[model samples]
Target: MPDSDLLLIGLGNPGAKYDFNRHNVGFLIIDELARRWGFSLSAGKWQSQSCRERKWGSRVLMVKPQTFMNRSGQAVAEFAKFYKIPLQHIIVIHDDLDMHPGRLKLVQGGGAGGHNGIRSITQSLGGNDFFRLKIGIGRPGRGEVHPEIPVESYVLSNMGAEEQEILESRFDPIEEGLRTFIESGVAKAMSLINSIK
Candidate 1:
């Protein structure tokens, strides 16, 4: 088997019922990348659905963890161990409540920001040195219509059509950022992606 130079892990819950939820943006981004790159995620291993593809002169492994959100690190750590991928080469994509919808930011070696999936990955890896592509899913503010909704309930809820539209509009920039990260390095990708509105 060919070794992957970079491992892209998308953190999300597995199951049809949770497919469209806000927390599943990671899965959605992976799906888009797979579709755009002509790779099919039909293989299952290491508690993840995975596919390999050579893009921009690098072998990339794309994985969607089946271990659900909180336990996602198990799958990620397993794949990283088997592939001998360093922490710096592992990139995780997940939803963020820090920014409004349609916004994204790329960072390396940061705290989990209260994201359970990220917390799990950080613990499993014994550190928080990997890269993360945070897709924002803005939280309900005080006195908002859903102000009473808890963060857990809000994240699991499906996105409204308008929110989905906004997200769809940001995919192009996200893809470019990913490509830059894979081909160059995280710093370069961060500079480009973080500058995006």
Candidate 2:
């Protein structure tokens, strides 16, 4: 009901059909955080399950939109305006096929690279001033397990067991990066996270 000091979004398609896909890593992280923090993840004013957490005096409102991935902009834009969370205070976590598995990148304002969810957010927010915590899923071709399945098919397909293993291993590290981002600032977070090899 009240504005949040921070809003973190994890982009992913809705429905059990996409629950295990690489692209749904964002959703997975959101769910995992809810489980770890003992948050109810109950429905809120914006029709999103908002998990509340306070770190460094910041009331972080984490949302995993029930809307399918591409329509993410609608939920994010509306919720942000309601809470008055500035673009700078918004961070999106999504899977990136360009980077190796378990890799993460922090970027601000750029092309969507065919990610409809990001594209929708950019369009809805009127610009790309927000930050993105990109989790790399690795390119499909060139000896990788996944192939370029066009944006739609690729994001919907389930992750292989091996891929899931990799993701399971990186969960804590991702959470740590988020913790640093919340306790410190993005610059400091990046400095601490970018070099994680």
Candidate 3:
């Protein structure tokens, strides 16, 4: 059993090849958090890699689902069920194509907005009440090599140098905002993250 009821899940397709893809921003955030916290992830029975630590008076379980992007909920559901964690206590971090790169939005209880991972989690958890930290990756445009790349291909592709730098620069703020979330709640976190220019 888990010592804490709070859970944080980062969404991405598992494997080295997809490491820097636009769809893997959540995983990148998880990796950065792990680096900053000095924690390490280990394979878990729920088909996820995770680390646990007490932060801000909460025993937080940070997880990276290994069940791939679409099936992420399978691992998340297993862990949540085993830990007996409530929906409101769970937070998911994922990429969003609707907003420009480097943008972040923290919110609770909403639709998936066409994200398969969020949709899967909502379906498996039987509700959309969980919190979400959205990292914007933006939609592809005609300036790229392909005149019209499909959304799937665009997201699965690795991020360009400029985009990568922009996103990386926001990591510090993201960390601060997440700390706010852990220390307070989604509302405060949203105020901090969403205000980032």
How large an RMSD does model 1 have? 2.4
Clashes of each: 0, 1, 0
- How do the candidates rank by TM-score, highest first? 1, 3, 2
* Superposition TM-score, candidate 1 onto the true structure: 0.93
What C-alpha lDDT do the candidate models reach, one value each? 0.87, 0.81, 0.87
Work out how many backbone clashes candidate 1 has: 0
Give the runs in model 2 whose Cα sits over 4 Å from its true position.
Answer: 1-4, 147-151
Measured against the true structure, the TM-scores of the candidates, in listed sequence, are: 0.93, 0.90, 0.92
lDDT of 2 by residue, 76-179 (tens): 99988988889988989999877888777888889998788999999999999999988888776735644656645665788888888888877787778777
Per-residue alpha-carbon lDDT of candidate 1 for residues 89-151, written as tens digits (9 for 90 to 100): 888999998787867898888888999999999999888888898998888763342677788
lDDT of 3 by residue, 55-116 (tens): 76778889999999999998888888988899988989999988777788888888889999
lDDT of 3 at 169: 93
Ranked by TM-score, the better of candidates 2 and 3 is 3
Q: In model 2, which range of ten residues has the least summed lDDT?
A: 142-151
Please state every model's RMSD to the true fold in angstroms. Answer: 2.4, 2.7, 2.6
